[model samples]
Target: MALNFYGLDLIVASNIGTIKHVKYNSNPNKKPDIKQLQRIKELEKGQGITCMTWADAEQTKFIVGRKDRTVQTFNLITDEFSDTKSVDFGEGKLQSVSVFGESIFGAVESGVIKIWKSNTSDEHLLNTGGPIEKMKHCSYNSSIIATGGKENDLKLWDLEKRTTTFHAKNVPHDWLQLRVPIWVSDICFLPENNGNVVAVCSRYGAVRLYDARAQRRPVCNVDFKDQAGSCISLGHYDKHVIVGTGRGLLNLVDLRKKGKLSKSYKGAVGAITDVMSQKDANVVVSTSLDRHLRIHNAESKEIILKQYLTSKLTCFLLRTVDSFIKQEDGEITIKQEIDDSEIKDEDEPDQEYDEMFDNMEIIREGISSKIEKNIFLEDKTKDVTVSKKKMKSEAKKRKGNDTINDASISEDLIDSPKKAKLDKEEEKVNDEDIDQSIIKLLRSTEKLKRKLLSKNKKKKAKSLFYK
Candidate 1:
């Protein structure tokens, strides 16, 4: 799901074989009315939608990756879906999809990444060592993207050069000389830099920061021992990074402090799958495997909005009303400009004239309703109804007609005895034919039974001879 420029929330949720567009009531105090929560529209989906990314800056069009190994485009303005502008990845399941300006990036479970320079048939493929869990395009430099998963640690790739940019070297060995296994779950490019710095979270509960231009080894590493870090998102102004852990903890890491954990937000009961920061960064929204979507205050670390949806939600986008309004440059001005031609005079009779017309409209509507009611009454009176006496007369007439019909039937019955005898003879002939067919079937069954008995006797004789 993606947010539109109008600050209206749009999310695609699963419904049978299709996806539904759900718009939430953004008002915090007012509960969403159930009647208004009707499905906006349903788009046919092959398998389930795995990932989605905006296709345009206005967020009118978005590309969705499905488990069926295909990508589709959905247009919000027209409420239409186009699978024509798609790239198929054979049998691999899509792990993530990203839209970076004119290029589309998709990573799949087969360790292959597909890139489309434009929304056309032309595409390019890049192979990683193993399945990719997450791939994020660099916002600072559109030509760079970061991918990490499974056996593949964090690696930055330059789209223009089509080569690996930063290959993170492992941090040697532990004090006991045990080699750490590489399992990067998610990666994000730092926006503050010129696509040189990147951060990654791993299944080993480690968050590492690597600078592509500077070093092969991670510049900073922090491990939260309790649970694994599944996803990471940058905080406001890139001051801190919000890590969603497998234990449902939101850890705020300060970048200036060498990736130190500053604060923690709690309240989720299951593993956090995804987390997104609002434009202001004051509020962060997260989805968990426990079927809950939560919004938390960044400063106080308090839960602001916690809603439990019945289905397992993987992704969601939030848009606020302030994004639509232009920011004020300076303080409000007391003086304003007005045109004389557009001004209205207080002595004019426009208000009185409008009031008179409104009164006449109300009177006419009332008279039309009264006339309709009278016509309905007249129609009801015109309906014909029979009395009890007329009803009894009709019943008697029907009884007499039935007796006359019965007499006719008796006369016809008496006139056809010869035909009845002939029919009986024909029935007898049919019975004989049925008996003959049954006898033939019985004979065939007896012959089959005899052949089986002969075979069994022969087998017994052969067994005795062998003994």
Candidate 2:
């Protein structure tokens, strides 16, 4: 009630007088989140809230009815309670509240309607009954109201005329020809219906739509399977009304003439206490004794948001406009819901980022694939050694060459056995300056062998031995 919602917009009140504002997630895959929560400090330990309604369209002021048998006016702007329009009914708790024609009305379960800001001496209007279960102020006509309760059938009242305009008769009979006891738990006036069409839910799981201008009995009748229907709500464009049951069931029911029931929204684990639908969208919200507030996409029958409020939610109000509702100036308007498939592309890639990606270099191959081309797998890896047979073959071919010296051929032959395992770089020694003496030849051979042994230690010392 904290300037939270004007209707189907936001703000839920729990049994302990705590108000919470929640935001809906249009994506069914993600959960809804709670935005704010506040407890009414003035409400004491023993009091119980029975009713809540916006006192003005600006959402600056609101009304609260408590089990203490008092109806109080609260100001959202000042965040305080005012005594000007507050009233102590002195009996039963108020079940319904309405602000219309510049007067405030508090209707009690005892069939008494207390009118504030009245010019007449008689401030309280009485129905010819002792108790009423539910009462709804007509949306299309502020002067008209609808009421129903235990043993009391649905009735429409004209506040200006101070008379009952229509009374609904009991359902004719069952297949067994027995009576269907009356126990209407909640009533909702259909939008744009001139206050003549209403949707009602009974404690016996019956959902009935009444067209006052057409007939006294219900025009369309449907039963909620295995769950007692407790509350109902209608939206501006909805061909159906969302119904809440005593056992935590919420579903849209096509209750017009030639209508059928819609799919069920699954989540709550306790009795549903209240339900509301956004006027312009297929978004519906419900509260249950399970302490959870759930919003559903009525068209797809999916839950858009589910938030735990930490208290048994009894009732809530929301605006049909966006979350930034101008609650203080007039009725807070809630924004329309966006479907998941039709969500805006707000998360699209940035233009600069796309340009950077397009400008990046594209490599033909990865480094891993070229591990052996210009790179080696390990640091210890070396080239393949030349075969000893290949060295002998090359030396034989060079010995037969025309410009070779006999002494040079002898030096090469002397070195071939020791240098057989050497690499090509180590085999390039210049022996053209040899003296051709046997002692000199043996000395040169020893020097060449020592140098080759020091350079390529990978070949064992014995492999370089002169045989």
Candidate 3:
């Protein structure tokens, strides 16, 4: 798939207990602008923002779930935390929160889900089970919600009926006859099926797609080796979903191909806590335990922008660029200036590598000495080649002259066999002498090379001693 998103605007929550509003421009020269939106700044991530979801259709307000089991409303226009009255969920981590109609649906990690109307007094309490990891409301049908967690299989709940509509059955036993355990970490409803088809990722590193009408078991289950998926988001393309793994791996999985991985993303160093795609855009925003926010273009699968928020992040919400709050009547709006520290100099080299090169010691010989040695070797080769060529030429001339003299001797002394034979023997002697001279020259070149090398080595040794 191609990542076609031009820009990114989103909210990220760090595990260090901070919520940052990030506005990113596609321009390379400009850095992503981050503004702290949290009223309370602390030194921990769990207690700040654990989960987030948009509260309204206009993407103005969103629901924030905290570690202390409290659900709060945050509006982008007002830029203030409202409806902050804490809930009494006893003692458990707040998993997720979503708005359905006038009532708000909040799920806790302790498996306690509280449902109550907005701007009301009494709230309805329902205990689904223990240790719920994720609870998400289907955008297609507001009343429908999905819940899954560790040891908790995927289940669909109808708010109006207050009944479980679909319960997913686990995969069959493995080859060793061992039953696979259930550990659903995140749930996402596919918009294509009108909330009938759903996708869920587990801590076991598997992404499964279940069709409520087709069967209880997952029709497509793709398992990633050595990487457990912590969160899942719908992909920009159809039948595709982006899965952020527990070991800092972000992968795009195709639902149509039995969970085949289409693309893998880079730049996350810590386990990804959440990955979300902007509606109607190919941009994907992910939060990780590494205390940074990264925006990826899903189509290109390249990390276009990265911002160090200095919080071990848990979750985030992707707000499109068009959804930015504008100046309303009687409302104050001022452009915030970004600090120099917030802008990352990506072109600068790492300090460690720079120091290493700067402190490096030069142990090799001087450059001039190296150059001289090279020149000597080059001259040595040329001299040997020239000598060999001269030797060959001289040998050929001797052989030609000897052949001519032999022919003249035979023609001049046709009757005297002994005389001609003597002449021929003398010519053979001359040829042998020429061959010996050539052999001597070749042998002398080898000796000369050995002497030159020995002299050079001695000079080098003397130079080292003097130094």
Candidate 4:
């Protein structure tokens, strides 16, 4: 869940417990190596590490939020640890943490958002809301913070003013009580001069672009055919916004023009739990409930690297530096792969299996009926033609026979009503005989018909074309 930048020699907080040190190389020309640089020592006791924020450039000092409702600081240079400094905010758990300059901000489970300065004093600058679901620092302006949660409310707060700058309300409320809150999944400010623009995604499969400077509503919105599960995680690199959904889909939104879907990558087989962008912005990494860590090239949508992990990653942060570190001997050790085998198996019964079987049965029955109808129609046509030819030949034969026989015999044969009735009955019998033959063939060769039908299906499939 943590992103390590080799260039900056920094490792941000990830959800895999406490990973205080990273092994890396110093020189690009030499073989890769590992260095045991320790950042936090107290994390060895299995204290829950929920979120991390770097306070300095060297990444020597940082703050981490733990499950015990405490925030602790660690200094890498001195290899020292500080005990939790409790901030009184009722009883809700802290879900997210961020740093803007010397001030620190945390979003709690009770929907309350709080901020404190770097001096580590008992005083806090701002404490707002009951508990915040998600929070992020504004990219362009460090003074602004965006917060959202179960209430479907998005608030933009200005640290200087100590108040909300803009409050956007009435977000979709469906699925709010779901496993993952269906409110605002994630909100991110675009990079560079596009500070006024922000993208917000909801759990109801909606991605909307809003202009903070505009007086009206959002400029554009997309629903992805209403299939994007829930927008749980989001990242921004230049003009593109990458969104991770509950269904484990990584969607790329192009904001350069009006908002448009550029591409979508299969993030993982399970729900996407977290996503991070590398310092280069050309690549993105995501973690899923499927216990997979996937890295993708932003432009090509090609997976550059995929590693299986044992645990479901809950959160991830990328250090804003290259992934290479230098050593005295000019050796480099690439970032160590995270082992995610800690995730337990939680497969549930598939609910769609019965419906799928029913659909298949219906299709099979339709095909069988169509085949029977076609065979019956073809036999009836052939029998009618054969009967007409036979009748014409018998009439010609009778005429020739009569011309050679005596005139009295011909008159007697013509006057015989019983014979005429018998001829009519014979025609009816022939019709019934043809129908019985067709029925017998259909019943006796059912298995053969099935085989032929299968073969015809294969042939038709081969002839079908798909774009």
Candidate 5:
């Protein structure tokens, strides 16, 4: 994704062997217009794009790791894809690729990690371990990278020092005494934490937060409880994390609240494969195995836009910029919208099947009128009550003490079981009516005899001394 002087543009690399370019419409007056996304160009990659990262500081060139065990660079200026560069790490499948300053880092399924010097083709093999599925370079410090996977756990490496910086320790066993499995599917470094904090979601259904400087264990851990966490994306709020689950459930978790689930979004029909949030925490884009992409309002927990794509989307990046237009000499053209009266019914398209985003106007009154509703019941302090003597006198006039309702029963009496008076209508039972216990007295006697015999033998052996 490049958001330089050329305007904000997103380069979407899909697993379906296609790379699409979407440019943000640069119309200032149309800022609030829903058509912020415009398809620019699309090219067939022939091979599925596995991983990608910016290859240069200018954001003009981006390197894409492919399923063919090779990396290719796409130049935004030229709009051309470069020839594939071979990965020598046992030709394993590329799991992730990251660019750090003047070097390119890649992790493969064969447990090989390599970094190539940006200026030359000189490849340097770093440390190797279990298959890595996710590798993210720190946003603030490009020299730091975080890697995690099944059995691999979370580990941080510093390219500058050429050594492992942090080694994550597995979380302790749960209350059930079962070891928690480590299968980190997605990871994101906290942008506001100066690279000291990172959040990761595991296929084992947990969102864990780690503070590298604190301890090896996660500072906070939360489980989805219903479905495995498929992917995770950081929200606009520093402590907020948006996680997509295997059950198509989207949950917003707040780290400050002990990683409690703050809100949930519905509408996905299949397992959520990827999730990415716009700069606005309120807007979230998600892709699911249902072959659809959906944009949701995080606060409302409602889907605002949904589109059925041609193939399953493995990942996506949303690049947004400040109002796309650059002002000129005071004169501005305002595109007027067609009045509802002018649009004839016959000219209107069938919108029942239209899945495109619609421009709608929303008027916000105030926060109190919106999300902050009456969280508590009306106060009982204003309620009036009759005197105990008055109530008792009224009850007596109704029908003596028998008039008391079940709700008025004393707490002690309610707790105690009442003795039932057997009448002629009540059924009587004899000893035969009850079922006897199934335990056999003979079996118990035999078991007791065996235990006694063993105990006697052990006592005699102890008496004979330590031979």
Candidate 6:
């Protein structure tokens, strides 16, 4: 259900089966030793890893929501499993579970949300409402929960009050018999703010920021050209807000400057299943249905690292903490054995590293040709400088021609035949000049094409010589 990466260790949540201990940076394709594979096989049985969270380095707790509407919690430190606790909610499966302080919240399929106090018996905080699609805790306080549901509504709930604090509704209307409406996909609270403003995304390709304290209206909405998929994840660092949509698109929006999308990264071939931001905010890791985990520089939107996986990663968590040891003799000792099976082989070397560096010279000649191709494909209307220069040149030519025509007409007005002959000659010359201008433009384009071809041929020759 979830994989939590802490330092160099990977804590996997196997809902009902045993938890897997894997190296954080290991490769999935690498073969494990006999004993390690056997251990992994044991953990892969039954309902599989459900959901796991680290209570500490020595302890972890995971909940397995079984098909029979039962939940079981396993303590990894004690190796003791709790008795199966049957969920009182009618015959629906548990969709998601979250732990906050001393409480656990479960979103069930029966359109009901249940809460249980960890210290007390497995009882519900409020057995109200239908199934919630997604739920998240406000970063500022764990007591507040944000829920989105099938009804296309976002509700803010206060645990202490045990009631709804604020609700935003999406209503449908019919104009000319067209039913148009909005549906909430995901919601997140901005960092450092006490749930004062929340960013909500919808399936209709719009992301909106709402102020809970203000009237029931959105502060700003951003519309994208593509239809966003179901999942929407948000990460905030300083004034930058990183948003990931289900359509495998990543956007960085600056809160300080409204209505501006600063950077975007496009790499995921399929829907993005989850996104986890590093504590430093410079790097963000995302998993998609394409079975790849990609790391991107949040500021530059460039891919730094990409790891291929065997399975689609559903959820992931990252945390930074102190190293798990004290410096006694200027050395750090780890109690657990290092699992080297996870480190994958680097992509096959096409050539020796030094040889490849030397061979890169072949691409240098081709770069200019590629650049020209890109420029030609780009929107010409956006070339402000070129358009301005063309306009100025045309204006000066028009002024000179007007003065010439005026002087010729004034001097030849007395003689009708001579004036008529002069007029005809001038018209022919004017037409020739117009034709030459058109021909000159065409020839310039042809010259660029020939230059591009020459550069490409040289690059090809260089490539073959290197081979």
Which structure among the candidates has the greatest TM-score? 3
Give all candidates' CA lDDT scores.
Answer: 0.67, 0.68, 0.77, 0.61, 0.67, 0.58
Worst lDDT run of 10 residues, candidate 6, spans 31-40
Q: Write the per-residue lDDT of candidate 2 for residues 1-467, one digit (tens) a residue.
A: 32222224466777776565554544445444453334455458645667788877756567777666666676654556774344555356678887877777877777777776745555756573657878888878988888888888888888888789998988888899999888999998877778888888888988888888889888988876677888888743455877888778777787656667767788889998988876455567788999878777766767766777766788887754333434436655554445546644331213334566899999856665335432532321222122334445665566455235434566665477654444333334412222233345456546655665565564454475832
The alpha-carbon lDDT assigned to residue 333 of candidate 6 equals 62
Candidate 4 ranges beyond 4 A from true positions: 1-16, 20-47, 76-83, 118-122, 125-131, 169-182, 193-195, 225-238, 256-258, 279-281, 322-467
* CA deviation > 4 Å runs, candidate 6: 1-86, 90-92, 125-131, 169-180, 255-258, 279-281, 324-467
1 versus 5: better lDDT goes to: 1
Query: Best-fitting candidate, measured by lDDT?
Result: 3
TM per candidate comes to 0.62, 0.63, 0.67, 0.57, 0.62, 0.57
Of candidates 3 and 1, the better by TM-score? 3
Pick the winner on TM-score between candidates 2 and 6: 2
* Candidate 5 minimal-lDDT segment of 10 residues: 376-385
Candidate 6's residue-wise lDDT over 86-123, tens digit each?
Answer: 66765356655666666667766555777887568756
Comparing 4 and 6 by lDDT, which wins? 4
Ranking by lDDT: 3, 2, 1, 5, 4, 6
Q: TM-score of the candidate numbered 1?
A: 0.62
lDDT of 4: 0.61
Model 3 lDDT, residue 235, Cα: 86
